[model samples]
Target: MKATTFPGMSLDIDIQELTPVQWPALEKLFGKNGACVGCWCMFWRLEEGERFQDVKGASAKQRMKALVAQGQARGLLAYVEGEPVGWLTFGPRRSFPRLDRAPSLKCDDADEVWSLPCFFIHKDFRNQGVATALLKFAMDTLRQRGVSTLEGYPVKVPAGATRVANSSAYTGTVPFFEKQGFKSVAERPQGKQRMRKSLVLRRSARKQGS
Candidate 1:
């Protein structure tokens, strides 16, 4: 589907500015289930539950909250009439240890880029393209900041790979990334669906009269 299919639902949602004050809503969204068993959506954050296995839920949340206070903008928030319904975590890839574990993602690039790490949509508002909009906003924000490289780890969905409920598999699916205009520059080095997109470049201002 397309955005138009969901009439009166308003794909023209308000992409709220994320702030520490809004942390509570995010916390509620994750709940005691750990945002799918206490992840706080930190799937790529650890290597098969090594580092994060000890962090627990409440403490991990505290850590993320601190990030917000430390001037770390925690991605975009998808809101419907002031209620936060979805989220997309976008930032420099280095900050999220999850992506580093995947050699195929190649975190060593010094060019400095933003990563569309993951998306979380409220149960009620899912399938409405909310994540896609948040993603687009993230890209637009990055572009305005002069960022040209963005990456997302989606899925190759092996032929006949049986998908299950909440089976995000951490890495998103191919269709989702493709919808945002991302292309596969690499394949599964450790996992599948490592996609990339090159943003439109803005010409640098010439040094007066140069």
Candidate 2:
């Protein structure tokens, strides 16, 4: 697919895997609010008590930095003319502790699977295709890494609703995932839906091509 311009942004967008060196870019995109009340994208990594009690902000940022520094399987960042504009995180389902107990989002298979639970697009880049683009990039990255199955937990957007608020749509909408070749595998509580995709690719070829 051709690179497309992000709305209100001058240059075309590109996606790159997140790294420790890119912390500054993530911080800049998240801003002082920490991308939804200081979440820093660690809402699903923390324990239930911590996530619900509002124990975020600098602490959450530090935790995420630790993950990046440790070379843990994180997500990718979207850049437009070198400015970070979006973030999408995913990894082995086990890497995320909270998913173990998330109602209706629990593990359903024993095979190796990656879970994409969240995304954060810069306020200026919202309503654009940033999230979708990042998701596609993620699929290719995962496939090259030998991942065969990918799962996602998305929200069910109300029928006829033009737009959902950022806070409620962080997990993505069902329709969006479907368009990306994901199918509904299960339904979770609170309008949440579980989706999955089986990938077919020559993992060895990716390494050789590189």
Tell me the whole-model lDDT of each prediction, alpha carbons only: 0.69, 0.81
Error of 2 at 13 (Å): 1.0
Q: State every prediction's TM-score relative to the real structure.
A: 0.80, 0.85
Off by over 4 Å in 1: 1-12, 43-50, 107-111, 161-164, 189-191, 202-210
Candidate with the greatest TM-score versus the true structure: 2
| Model 1: per-residue Cα lDDT over 40-135, one tens digit each | 766554545576767757766776777776757467677776677787887777767667666667656724767877777788887787776777
- lDDT: worst 10-residue window of model 2: 1-10
Error of 2 at 199 (Å): 1.1
lDDT by residue for model 2 (84-161), tens: 999999888887778777767776573477889999998888867789888888888787678899998889877777
Model 1: lDDT equals 0.69
